[model samples]
Target chain A: MAGPKYVLEVENVHRIYESAAGYTHAIRGVTLRVPRGEFLCIMGPSGSGKSTLMNILGGLDRPTAGVYKLEGVSTSELDDDELAELRARRLGFVFQRYNLLPRATVLRNVMMPLIYTNVPVAERELRAYKALRVVGLPEEYYDHRSNELSGGQMQRVAIARALVNDPALILADEPTGALDSATSELVMELFAKLSEQGKTIVVITHDPDTSSWGDRTVHIRDGRLFTEEEERALIEAAMRSGADINARRGHT
Target chain B: MRPGDLAQETWSALSANKGRSALTILGIVIGIGAVITMTSIIGGISNSMAGMFGANAARVLTINLHGISNFTLDDVAELAKNIPDVEYTMPKAQIQHEATYEKTKVQATIHGEVNKVFEAHGYKLLQGSGFTEEDEKRGSREIILDQYSVRNLFGNTDAAVVGKSLKIGNDEYMIIGVADKVNTFSMTQYDSQSIEGIVPITTAITRLTGNPNITSIEAMTSATSDADAVAAQTKEYLSRRYKLQDSKEEGATRTVSVESNKQLMQQVTSMTSSFQAIMVTVSGISLLVGGIGIMNMMLTNVTERIREIGLRKALGAKRFDITSQFILESICLCLTGGFIGVVLGLLGSFALCGIVGAGLAAAVTGSADPVLPVIDPGAILNAVLTCVITGLIFGWYPARRAAKLDPVESLNHQ
Candidate 1:
């Protein structure tokens, strides 16, 4: 059988959470596809279900009523441990807080993923060093504890950690949410550079400026995806209704 | 994850909170230490009690006749011949008298016995030979002085009192031999100023006391026979021969007392073992409490490291991986405490033995060897096994909780 043409495929996925109070439809019907080596950004407001989508895409969770495939393998069929294995070998995640072990050295943090993958000890350090070099982290800072580094340096270490495993897709959630604008620009530039190198990247964020770095941006509202043109139309229509209200207020 | 990696992770996690880890194992240390100390001391006491007699002490019995008895050497030989299990029998008698050797004088309890008494009591002849049967037959005034009596009448035990004349109750007897002090198990240590000596039964009867009566007979049972049974048979034979009655009614005066070494040993062994059992139960309670402490600390560790557990899971750690890591940590803690407890207990037992020995020397016996604690390898092995089992029992629930955590929720935990 031929391998999958797209790195990720999600069709009509739905997510529902049940609690003592009632049921919550976090995701209704969402479909998405990203071809190999494509940089896609999924943008949404708070509570807009972007995180839920990211969780499904990263195989951290299973879709309730959809077939989500990664590299031609359906993830919904995999058990918890198999999903964890998929995450370990096929996906890399970067969080907004730069979730590095606080007291561990930067090099150690970068090598953490390989430890779980049963990688050889000798190659782990070499791959971590290569990842660090690619992310432009200074060699002197490799031995320092992650908490001792600046915000930007810590994020760089996290990106190195994500890149060390060489996953098929890099999923970063608000990669620059904690950094200043200048440091954010530097991080986005690094992601752009990784994209230019034919590395498939998906960045989930609310900031338009952050999303602008991606090759394509998709907006989500009420658990539904919208293209750029459709999002513009929705914004213009909402503005038109507000203008009509102002005109009536003037007459009153 | 690889075993090396797992071990490294456990190390770092435990070392991160060194003070808490040390405090957590304190209960285990005390628990194991108490068990080790109690077993050592109790075991030592039991061993020394057995050591009080020679290794084959259970093979000997003593028969004492009282109240105008007419027991004689001929009767002892007759009893030895009649009793099926009796191997041999010797006559014994004791008399207190003042003894002197040229300006040195001492009070002594002189035993009238043959060489068999020295053999049965583990007495070593340090200087000279024992008296022969010829001397006993001739009723010669020859005596053998022990080291204590030798020291008392000759001013020092180093001087050979052999071939010298020693006045006893106005009769000067020739000293034929000098024997080492008999091991009475410190029974006579309190009588510091007194001495003891041995003489032929014939001489003691004809010369010293002017009596031809015997009072005590020491008998050794055959190796295959029980000492207690032999003693009973000996008593029955003597009772039948002498027409003795056990009742203390009017005019019933003759009685025989037969005691076996096995009987005395049985009583002492039962008492010591029961004491040991009670003490072990008390220590077991402490061990239980230690296990509970381990469980409490493990639970806290799981709660504190929720985010870490999440990250590891996301990095491909399975439930088994997480569980083993925590379990190994718990085992390490317990094993460390167990080993240290064993060392401390051994040291404590040694110190206690020294103190006991010193107290005995100063307040009771002048000198006796300290009771050495038995270092049982089986007990140490059991202690180690207990630690591991404790770790598994107490670490299971907490480790399960950690492994069962949802990665998403745990990663989002603040």
Candidate 2:
């Protein structure tokens, strides 16, 4: 039998953070989906719960209610180790900070995912080199430590790591958040290129310019998702009341 | 993760903080080194004592006669003949007196025994022939000097010391032989320059003390017989012969006292074992502290690498993978320390034995063999196993902490 048409399926997923103080709803019944090979972007300011939704999509977290399916497997049914296996084999995560082991070499960083998946040593290096080539990293810098690389090079190495496992979904959360405008453009172009090569890419970001590179963009506000028209009307209504949308966008 | 990859990661992680790792290893080194040193030294001493006591000594028993009790040569021979286990018997008397040869004068303990005492006591004759039965019967005024008295009286333990006349309490006696020194303990070697001579018991009683009584009768049991049982039988025989009762009072004059070398050997063995136990206990405390130090360093390593752990988790590392890596790092540290410790501990044992041997030789003014440390293979194996166990026990909590870290929270940690 063929697999599900969508690589990622989210159905009314909700995430709640419980603390000693009270229960705060981080994701209020959000639903979304991305078909195979689609470039999807989720846009929101810092407090819009996009990070929570991204965590759930990457299988780094599980929803408090509802189901999230990645590569046709429901995440809620899996234990921690099974979820880890699901992530290793099905989903790739690219974080805002790159999250490379700073002292490890570039090739070793890219091969990190394969290490968890019990890949053979010989094939690990070959796949790492292949991923690095796809991300356009030079062979000369393969042995250089990740910390010694520039921001854009580090992000590219991170992308190479994410792609090393050939995952079904590449979930990148603010991959260019630490880069300059020029490096951001290059990184977004690389993602667009990867998207066009039949890779399912879901990039979560706040900047509209970054979201413009994706085939579709969804805006999340106060733990709720909205289409472009609905977000614009909501922003227009917010501006009439003299609420600072720019200040909220700059909320870091 | 693959074992190879996990090992590589552990190695790199530890090597990243070389200084901290080295300092932590030092604690275990000192602990294991102290334990090995103490056990080896004690082991050497125990071996020496076993050599001294487990040979002819284990088959010998002594019966002391006091307060008008006496044993003639015939009586001793008759006792040996009557007892089934008795191999031989020798009677002895001791007299402490000043002896002189030419200008040399020294205080000497002169033992008066039968001719077979030399063989029974394991003293090797170094110079001349021992006294004959004829000499013993006739009270022939002949003497045999041990190495200590030979050197003191004639300036050497050479053959020339024999056939010399040595004065004892205004009576001159011919020196018939020179024997090697009797065994002495390492602890008392530095204090006593033992001067000893042997003569016939008949001569000692008639010439020196002017007393017609034997002080002690020594008996040897056959090798296959129990020395303790023979000792008890000998005591019973003596009590019947003297018509004496087993005294309950602290200082009874009419009671017979029977002592066996086997009992003495047991006492010495137990003493050494207790000392080893105490020393091991003290070293165990150090090991505890060292284990705590390892735990502290591992906890800090977990804290410092929290984000790295989270990243590995996000990359699909299982809890077992993370835990094993940290535990392996700790085991590596302790095993390295323990290896170096074993080596240094052996060297330390050798040096201590050398000093003790030299001190004994200096006090006796002669050569003494050094105690050879008995390094038990079992002990070393146990040390290594202890190191691995220490690593496992101390590394557990921190590794569990690393494994239990929430991936999302750890990733977001600043």
The candidate that wins on lDDT is 2
Candidate 1: residue B293 Cα off by (Å): 2.7
Give me the TM-scores for chain A across all models, comma-separated: 0.94, 0.94
**Per-residue lDDT of A144-166 in model 1, one digit per residue for the tens?**
98999999999999999989998
Top candidate on DockQ is: 2
| Second chain alone, TM-score for each candidate | 0.84, 0.85
Q: How many residue pairs clash in each candidate?
A: 0, 0
lDDT by residue (B242-286, candidate 2, tens digit) is: 776777767777777888888887887899899999998898888
TM-score of 1: 0.84
Q: After superposition, how far is residue A177 of candidate 1 from its true place, in Å?
A: 1.9
Task: Give Cα distance to truth, residue B122, candidate 2, Å.
Answer: 4.4
Model 2 misplacement above 4 A: A232-252, B51-54, B66-70, B81-84, B114-142, B156-160, B169-177, B183-194, B200-215, B222-224, B237-244, B249-255, B355-374
State the weakest 10-residue window (summed lDDT) of model 2 chain B.
B183-192
Model 1 Cα lDDT, one tens digit per residue, B154-190: 6676787778998888889888787655535432334
Worst 10 residues of 1 chain A by lDDT: A243-252
Give per-residue lDDT, candidate 2, residue A152. Answer: 98
